[model samples]
Target chain A: MTSLGRGASVALTDLEKSYDRVAAVAGVSLDIRSGEFLTLLGPSGSGKTTTLMMIAGFETPTAGDIAIDGTSVVGMPPYRRNIGMVFQNYALFPHLTVEENIGFPLKQRGMPKPERAKLVGEALELVHLPGYGGRYPRQLSGGQQQRVALARAIVFKPRLLLMDEPLGALDKQLRENLQLEMRRLHADLGITFIYVTHDQEEALTMSDRIAVMNDGLVAQVGSPEDLYDRPSSRFVAAFIGESNFLPATVRGMEDDVVVAECEGAIVRAICPGRPASGDRVLLTTRPERLRFTDGAWSSSAPQNRMNVTVTEAVFAGERCRYMLQAADGTAMVLKEPSSAAIRRRAVGERTEIAWSVADTILV
Target chain B: MNLVQAIAGRVLPTTVVGLILLFLIFPIVVVMVVSFSSATYLTFPPPAFDLRWYKAYFGNEDWLRPTWLSIWVAAAVVILSTLLGTLAALGIARLPPALRVVASGLILSPLIVPVIVVAIGIYYAFSRYGLVGTPVALVLAHTCLAVPFVVTSVSASLSGIDPRLQQASLSLGATPIGTFFQVTLPLIRPGVLVGALFAFITSFDELVVSLFLSGSGAVTLPRRMWDDLRFAIDPTIAAVSTLTIVLTVALMGCAHLLRKRAT
Candidate 1:
């Protein structure tokens, strides 16, 4: 089998789609680099799948243009676009044996018999199913069938590959296994991949870049660390992982840091976007960022501490989560690695929580 | 338990199913017995066994002519109805749900309308154009009756195929027509075969429409059989019935084989 050439870069300019009066994807513009594994991550009905369909050319944008490798392909049909897609259901042709299914694209292009057979065998080997060519899709397990689908999609050596939740139907263990395989395939093939999924952990684990979508619009697009550490919106902060949002007002700016007043206390944090003084904002921090003061409340600086009552504690083997309520009744959860010294505090016992100023974010 | 009690435990459902089976098979068995009878008139369990009626059925021009006519007419109906019904099913499957339901009901109206009523209506319409009793008229009428079966069967098969298969084929660089031929058609082969079988059988065994529409020019097998029953108790008609039973069983076996291969 021939290796895929240098991957195609895609540019979606002001892409939008609507079904009757309902907007499925609303005004999305994204630049995808060649050979990058970009994931469109979101909850259900969040327009991620629609965006992928638009890129695959199955969907015609209601208003906008799409270009592949600097050439506009707005009205082009999917077949002529030369892209590979793996559907959520796998969509392996049930009538064809595994070899025929993997060689379908080549067969359509009228590849000769001997060449086609050689390529089909090579494609099967790529998916680690070397001897499964004669078996029908129904005879194989779900994971094996999925691998066949992957083999079929990539056997044509298309410039781009799009996957719509390809492992959504498999069990957790199998899904994780396939996720690693997919990463290896992407690396080996070195093709642009635009994957759509609602599973945040899968997106975080496999993607070179992620575009977290919300309500038909892209909320944020960045690397996994960029999104986790510096989410630009409340929706991104909450959707990517767990977070605590505290209401605050911007007080002043100091170089890269912004001082904010939160819950009758002054908190200093790094803000990517500057806001005017007295502007209402949210102070966001991750659950793991918070730490127990170890009863030395007055030893630390006064501005970054909160006195709270422990309401509930859950022990989860390696880590413990403590639910606490501040003096004004704002609830927050703190997570720390489990240890012999850590014990469930008595219900209603007052405690102090603190975090580094660098970890706090003003959104 | 005693023998009576043990038997009683199974007797109720077993007896019910047995009666139903007997009710269905008894007439066919009697027809087969009479077809081999040595007697001159229709009778059950003749004193001797022979193939006299079978020989008569094959040798007689009146019976042989109509039998060939019915076979050709049913073949024509199968081809015409399968083509029309498969196209209609594909088109209807793509329509919006509300319109699809309405279109399906309209297409299937012949099955819901009384057969005699449809026959009379067709007779009235065809009589005006001097088309009554012609092979074309009969084939058209039977197509109307059989298209619904084809539609329902093919529609069911089309629905069973995941729509994504077509999308995947296109995404893998197959054109729309290629996808339909290579992916959609093979997946729906069993349904189409079953539908064609139903169309063929419906046209072949139809009696009421032929009774209303058949002239001396287009005497179907059932029309000739009806005439024979009215004029005389010919055991040759029994042989015809037996042949039809065998044909139907063979057709069913073919359809079953198709379904098995599809899965």
Candidate 2:
């Protein structure tokens, strides 16, 4: 789905941003590959948007260097940066028509009228809003306006695009539709996309790489699978997706797996020689990874097993979610597909929760 | 509700508003009607209606000169105040809250101070420079009174424009100055126009400063009218007043239309 467009490689080294003596983005360093869709994912005030702003040249970095295609652009002004940006509010010029808005960058570059009009028409077609060139932004719907903004940003064919929560204002269904469209556009343009969003799910769905930020620093940067399956910190594990974290004490090691005692239950995780015996760690596992022992092909020797009392059982269409409390009152959720040959556990029922070592990780 | 109480509830406000309107418009109406009278002296409820007074106002050179002087002075004042006020508003829009407050108060001080005090101060300053009776002095003095209205109008318009629109323009490869011209200037035109109108009317109707600054060649309409009031109570003065009122009303209507179009 990659488009025929050039992309630039961006690298930030030891970036530090502070406002009024308070650090907004502190010492962030990341390399963005050409044509890669990298998302800065974090909650509000977590410096993700600030980092995007810094990259867009709208915010001056107090310390550090940003290089585009191996050239330092630390002092370059925004107008000279040759980068496209879409603001959260869409920021379409209300006074200009759609064609004029898309043609603005070309006009600024002193492009001739004929060529500019052709490019604007192509941009309109690219955003699937052909014949909408004559209309003003106020005459368009929210979603259509958002598409126009996107079209305007890309019309000049900049090497890099920066978006700050571009779809945060749309409703859920439209947001989802646009999320797919954005991913497709990223692929089609083949331009490096540095997207910023507080929604982790959008980042996971669209980005080739996700930079999970906390406070003012990046907690982890990895692919979606890597971030989900092997989070480096507790913040990444909790922020990326749902996970039940249990305090564990390392017990023993066998091959690549480390055995640990979690509360009153024995747990095991696939470890690469990090946790030594007697070391404290947090054992985390996804709810869907756990299973009820009686329904599943019973594992004669599972790595982890705990006796739990079913506190609440909910049938959530696609999956049956069971909220269970272990013997030590540590709550855990076990999700099993409704379509699978699984027995549903009722509330207040006794059960045994089992999971293999491959499904858990110690952070 | 009973008929009397309901009628009173509605008719009371209507009657009060009608009385206030009558009170406010009565003098202007009387002046308009008296201006049309054929009598040579100022007399209401004349015996016959004639255009002789309007003819006298147009045919006379002294009255015509002052009218031309007022128009030119008001035009010059409008240009000066609009320029200074728009620039001042732009500067104030970017200033921090505390400094902006101080700046605004300083700029609007002329409006808050008594007109007579301002006029006396200007007269003193202009006399020192031998500019007491110059049109430039009159224009400068009028500009000081009119700038605050321009500032307030432009400031309101500037606030209405989203700051993000400027940021968006910058992001789209327009420089700050370019953004101001391309994005900001057009959006704030209504405010600037309103300010210009205010400056125009302020200079046209100004009497306090004009009384001190206007001389033989630079006499404004208001100053000439004051002279006529002191010397002769002619029906031509009434005709001039009717014309001034008409011009002011037409200008206000234009301002209203401009504001409506802008929104």
Candidate 3:
């Protein structure tokens, strides 16, 4: 088969997959642009793995189209997809030498002997394991074996590389190192990298854009900063990064801002994606956005302030995290510079935590 | 008191194990002893040691022909059944759990059924098709008898293999078929060999099916021994039975080796 040309974007339109009518992936529609690195970030069983498998042509989608470069690949077998995929288990052929395993795909594609050898060589070089071709998979360490998997995937230069938690099996330090390596490889090769992971930190550090998934649906799609600073929903606010969500009722509305009251306190927030006026709202603010105050809401304070008692304190490297309990007893987590902390509060100390209206995003 | 109790605990189990071992091995020992009896009749602790019976086995033309036929037919059964059964096992292992259980039951049903009923049906069916008394008939019936063993052993072996081994092969860019041939077949070969040995031994030792199905032209060793028993009790017969026992033991040893290699 002739190889599919580059600039062929992988677009899934209303893709749905169900197993025994359980609806594993419920109406997942996505556009993964050519040469873009997109990570599908979600907790386990949220259907991110299913969606990735569907794109790799392993699990057939129950409904909708998956097109590569505008060509529908609904019933195409994985071998014919011209797509590279890495499994969580790092499924290298144990019987074959590492060199033979790397050459396997090219052999299947009927690349001539000389050409296949040249390509395999280039791949080994790219992965920095140039002389590892003769070694068996068992002979190598976990990280080296993972590098072999990556090299094999990129050897044929498939238009898209689908990774199903490829680093999920590695140790923490190894996983982070692979994350940075993958980010660099995705940039250097200019191939569309569709990464799947449950680790929020991994998605934040490596991807060009992240699609936060929950229960088989794309919850939110945005750059890291966008997802961090202005999440569009309560799920997104909680799933993407840690955030303090307070159940609040909208007190009033400005041009685009809403004043929501919770636990005998009022705070101004930008309406996240514009929920209706007078609606029950979820007010979210990051821990770093919160600042410790001297037990009073100053008139010149940015916009929103609440008086609460610090119930617990944690010492993070550069900051001290304080858990403040409002009168209604909803614990709010906030971080402040360690030096500026109020002598590091004990369990029952009182302090007012404040943030600007610009800091809180109401959904 | 403590020393006496410890001695009794160790000696009691050893004696019990010795009794079980003796009970299991006594038949083979008696058979070998009776084969060498100079009186030319079945006896335990043979009255006299002699090579006359062994010589009688070689001199008898009827005995030599059927013995060779049995050996050749068993080899054929081993070759054909192992190939078919291994492929079936691989396909069955890949199927969903419910389908796999159903397929396995159907394949192994012959083993569960009574041999007399199977022999009778095979006899009537072969005779009607003009296949009775031919070596082909015996070989085919024995192959069917051997196939389930092949299926079971191969399936057991394939089950122990990691399924992700195939998926790993595919993600390496090899097609599903390529993965099966290269990665899967090699890993499951020990199981296949174990099945092959069983298939060979089953065909070699089979009596009822051969008796009912063999024509004038086809005479396996067991069938020959059965016919000889009706006519007369000969020293050559005892010699041949002893030889068959030795060969069966050797084949079982090979099976043991194959099973250990599989793990």
Choose the strongest candidate by lDDT.
Answer: 1
For model 2, which pairs clash?
A: A2-A187, A3-A188
State the local distance difference test value for candidate 2.
0.90
> Across residues A1-363, which tens digit of lDDT does each residue of candidate 2 receive?
233347999999999999998999999999998899999999899999888888888889999999998889888988899899998979998889999999988888889999999999999998899999999999998899999999989999999999989998899999999999999998898999999999999999999999999888989999999999988788898998889988889999877888888868788887755667899888889999888776344665555777889999899999988888988788888888897566677899987778877778888
Candidate 2 Cα errors over 4 Å, as ranges: A1-5, A299-303, A339-342, B1-9
* Candidate 1 off by > 4 Å: A1-5, A295-303, A341-346, B1-10, B127-130, B260-263
Off by over 4 Å in 3: A1-8, A275-277, A295-303, A316-319, A337-342, B1-10, B33-43, B46-60, B94-99, B161-163, B168-176, B230-235
Predicted chain A of candidate 2: TM-score: 0.95
Candidate 2 lDDT for residue A91: 91
Docking class of 1: high
lDDT of each: 0.91, 0.90, 0.85
Best TM-score among the predictions, by candidate number: 2
Q: Of the candidates numbered 1 and 2, which has the greater TM-score value?
A: 2
TM-score of each: 0.93, 0.95, 0.91
lDDT of 3 by residue, B2-37 (tens): 888877989788989999999999987777878888
Per-residue accuracy of model 2 over B1-263 as CA lDDT, tens digit each: 78889779998889999999999999999999999998888887976899999999999998999999999999999999999999999999999999999999999999899999998999898999999888999989999999999999999999999877887787788888889888899889999999999899999999999998886658999999999999988899899999999999999999899889878
Worst 10 residues of 3 chain A by lDDT: A1-10
